[model samples]
Target: MPDHQYLLTLKHILDGLGRKGGLEDNLNGLLATMARELGYVRCFLAITDTEDEDLKLSLSYSPSKADSVSYAPGRGVVGQVFENGETVVVQRISDNPNFLNLAFGRTEEEMARLSFICTPIVSHSRGKPEVVGVLSADLVMLPKDELEGHRSFLEAVASAIAHQVAILQEELAVQKHLLNQGMAGLPEAQPPKNFVASSKAMRLVLRQARQVSPSRATVLLRGESGTGKELLAEAIHAGSPRAERPLIKLNCAALPAELVESELFGHQKGAFTGAYQNKRGLFEVAHQGTLFLDEIGELSLDAQAKVLRAIQEKEITRVGGEMPIAVDVRLICATHQPLEDRIAQGKFREDLYYRINVFPVFIPSLRERREDILPLAEFFLEEFSSEYDKHIRRISTPAIELLSMYHWPGNVRELQNCVERAVLVCEEEVIRTYHLPPTLQTAESSSTEISLSFGEAVGKFEQELLVDALKKSRGNMLQAARDLRVSYRIVNYKVKKYGIDVKRFVNSKSRKR
Candidate 1:
């Protein structure tokens, strides 16, 4: 029962399918046939949708009973399949407590005696490894002699089922094909030039985003206001195969309750007052692309339901239109508030939070990544200076020092505005300390909360921040140094002064100052 031998036999059977009942029907019939032949009591085939909205259970055949039931992806064995892209083979399904039983009227003990095996079907269409759906087959009350043969047989049968599923979708003539191209571990393209992130905090976010970009998972972007959630959404969309297509952005909080639904789900002509013509909303416009729903934490419970349905069903019903319009769009959502807390308070739906938060990326506030403050200030100064027709060389060292010391609660957006305002009014080529906002100079002079000496306080804070960055970077010494905006020698000196193990943080992955 080697894998290679089994595969050859499978190819022969596929060649034979051309002459059977019908191409498509023969395929399904053979799938079930192989299931029973493999000494299984029943078989089930669940296929994940193109848009990855949810898994559609297509076949369920149980030999013991004549009846079969279809269940949702998150409801039964398929739920486990959707959650983890691995085979769930149970020799005794009833014995396992984690086995969320879907086998009708079967006790845990009874199910345990009946060996179970489930394989996740990774569709070639997406070209990414994921639990697209599952194929479940089991043997009832095996006495050990038949168990070995049954297990081997089911694996071969599972492979056959996967091929058939792919072919079926191909034959269906899907107008919008889900592109299979992308870095299996990275984005399809580099990040935006304007979307700057040299700091470790932002780098970590980028890393997480890339890791989940290729998979069929809903992305939940959590951050404070003006923390570049929309920018991150754009990065995700741009780095996807759908990059060439439209990126539909919806400010969920910007629209009123009366119009939010219509703005997102579209409405027919005369669906409501001011519906002068049939207007497609953000969702419809971004078809075959990405839909970034900003401020999702603000969505009403009723609005939350519609959004969840659109994600779960891969189809949306317009405000007035009864017929469901199937959409092929990847969803990337962003929110400025803590959605989990909101869910607890009942302001946001728990179900929607879970649905959208398949992969969550947290954008760190500017205060957390203070290393980027000076660079960001300079970049903005250059941008605004050029726009305003000024020849601003750069900020003076004292001015940059002042800018760096300020705790920007308003984050990068605030820094950009500050730099712009300063550049517009400044006279000299070198932006001086006086040109900076008064708050910055005040913060630089007396922002120190600790009563320790000037050097002592800075030393203590820098050492602690560097250590935290090292831990977050998984002991990458170079990354830690770069994150702290310090030289390698300075980081090494601190390591020795603090008696910290230098070898522990050895993986260097960043440039020196």
Candidate 2:
């Protein structure tokens, strides 16, 4: 191979990375480019799992039998390169004992004519060269001199794409972390106070919040209403160095448009009809602390200008006064509205948008993070039960199913209100399906439940009723049958049909009493 061909291959790899596509697609595109430009039959990119220290195949030039395959450190040639943080070249695949041939399953004849080269993709983002992944390719056996040069070229390509590969590795790490947790697993780590992050989406949001908390960079929280943008802003503030100082919050939309400037920047005495005395604005009040502006998109163009000036200059002028007051305050803005659309409509300033979007963290809606619904519901249940002086202990199975299945359009706020309403009307210790709002019980809301047929729904309800009766009767079939207004034979048949464990309910009753 000529030196120009190697340079051309590198150029093609760089071009492929710049194409518009997902990380996986772009990475696989790189592999495809390598296979086409350099006469290689197969190319693979394997990412190292941060938690488990295993090499998992992430991208392939051609479809292979390695979708589920992984190599433990030092287990195979790929693993050896990853473990040693060095490139490995096998002149002939058959000659290398470390070549496990587990991923591709190539025949013995094909192995005889192939040469292998594996290079570690090292990242220096942390100020140290660390191997994050491995890139390998197969080629027809080349002259020894040319083979050495090709190996160096492969190393160069690996170095060039290390940063991108590291980003992909971080994403994979987050996903693997989520998958390792049981579907219903309780959160083990205590996140910021009052923060519930049992779901993957919330965990990701929390991670972003924590990472950006230390910096004075402006953070824009974007999400639908009731998605806890304000809560997240508070979390970010509490984790920052400004935690000891005041965290002033202002709802930009809640204030009257005329009073928005007065509320934000304060007004000198007699500045307006309502300004009887000079009042310090939130910026001055939040000196050396943090200011959280909720519904920032609702700010008028004039207010946006002043806010942007304050952020850029780290100073603010009184509503009616000219002297600029220096304020050392970190800014966090939250908005459910699309700022981009607001800018397009000429309602918002583009410069201000860019400034506040320095570190934008999108808070996912409740529907997107369904795993959090139960935990959040329970949290609210405990709070409302205490406030109302009730003893609501837990949500019933049917109620849990309903809560999980419903699409919470209003996000956490709506869920909180729903749970509070249930607590107020729930007379029993356990909240049942009937206690939930009727909106959640609607056919449209619960459509995600496998599009349950009429008979299946009825049978599910019957089984729940039977289980409830058995719990009340301490698993006494005849007593439960009487309580449910059914005969013992029918109750027995339903119990068998639903796979109800009567003994467990009896044990629960015994423990409760």
Candidate 2 has what TM-score? 0.63
Residue range 395-474, candidate 1, lDDT tens digits: 76656766777778778888888898899889756677678777776644436443457787566655655655676566
Model 2 CA lDDT for position 56 = 86
Candidate with the greatest lDDT versus the true structure: 2
Q: Any idea what lDDT model 2 has?
A: 0.85
> Best candidate, TM-score-wise?
2
Q: Model 2 over residues 1-513: C-alpha lDDT tens digits?
A: 889998998999998888856778888888888888888888889988888788888888855565568888887898899889999999999988889998888889988998999999999866788999999988888777888988998899899888788878877775555455431232222254556766657767876775666667899999999998888888888777677899999999898999989988999998889788999999999999999999998999999999989988989999999899999999999999988898999999999999999999998888898878998998898889899999877888878988998888898999999999999999877798889899898877756645677798788778877877888788899999998888999999999988998887775562220
Give the Cα-based TM-score of candidate 1 against the true structure: 0.52
TM-score of each candidate structure, all chains considered together? 0.52, 0.63
Task: Give the poorly placed runs of model 1, Cα more than 4 Å off.
Answer: 1-189, 444-513
